[model samples]
Target: MAATNFVRGSVLKCSFPYVDRPSRPGPHPHYCLFVDSFEIRDRIYYAVCYGTSRLDEPLLENHNGAIFSVDSSLIKGSPMSMRVTHFVCSHVAVIPDRWVYRNFQARLDFIRPEGRKGDRLRERMYDQFVLLEPLMEYEALIAVNYVRKTGRPGLPGETTLR
Candidate 1:
């Protein structure tokens, strides 16, 4: 999917490279919700907040950031099969368009060499990465508003898109 197709509220299951662990074997695949997108010097960048099943009590209670929880039933056809997922609004990642495209192409290439089976695998991968269910507009608005209001620092420095 083209970066232009990614709008706010889109929930994508993509490989998020581990910034702290550069020596990790491969990209860490997970779900991320697109909260905002903008262009900088002709390059498109997306501001995304990560979704996790683990619930952090302290963070939810006293952290300056916001945490929005979504029941599994709210997410139609959830790939993660999580009973409850929380979006950490305070921790955001500004990802570049090229980073998204590069990882997508890499996944496709890895699955495309196996003939018919490869085709099926590629289709499933595409659905997860590009066509996954999206968060409701209201939910996205609340999350985005919290992030903005709290001025939570997003991922620092340039994200190393592996």
Candidate 2:
């Protein structure tokens, strides 16, 4: 997908050189939600945060990473068979302008709203993470809805959505 068309809820499989392993010598698959995207001069940038299955882990000392505890109810009716329950919202990443189109995979299934619980989570995630600019409430809601709503039954296609 083109960087110009990236949306808030898209789940992407990106290569992270930051994660290192003693036995592995290559980039690992870092799944993240496309929270925001913008163009600056000649390049386009995306703000993405890490998602994890370890809900027990702390936010840690990283100011760029924040983790949200998700539950089985959120994934039960969804399409992507993800095992994760927590999303690390503090670990915000700026997708390189060049790799936007190359690494994008598909949009996963999402859930609807869970009222105050969802609202509080969104507020907390946004407040803790440093963004290039202020994230609009609507935009945040869109991303949250994408994660909370059980919309479809398969990985979204490569076509640009929203």
Query: What tens digits encode model 1's per-residue C-alpha lDDT throughout 41-96?
Result: 45555566666777766656643335555554434333455676676654556555
lDDT of 2 at 84: 57
**Model 1 spans with C-alpha error above 4 angstroms:** 1-3, 17-26, 98-154, 157-162
Predicted structure with the largest lDDT when compared to the true one:
1
Kindly provide the TM-score of model 1 when superposed on the true structure, using C-alpha atoms. Answer: 0.51
**Candidate 1: pairs in clash:** none
* Clash count of each predicted structure: 0, 16
Best by TM-score: 1
Off by over 4 Å in 2: 1-3, 17-26, 60-66, 70-81, 97-162
Model 2 Cα lDDT, one tens digit per residue, 1-162: 236565544565554224322112125455566666644344455555555554432344342333444443333222344555444554444444444435345542332234224566544443443342234223334433332343311111221111
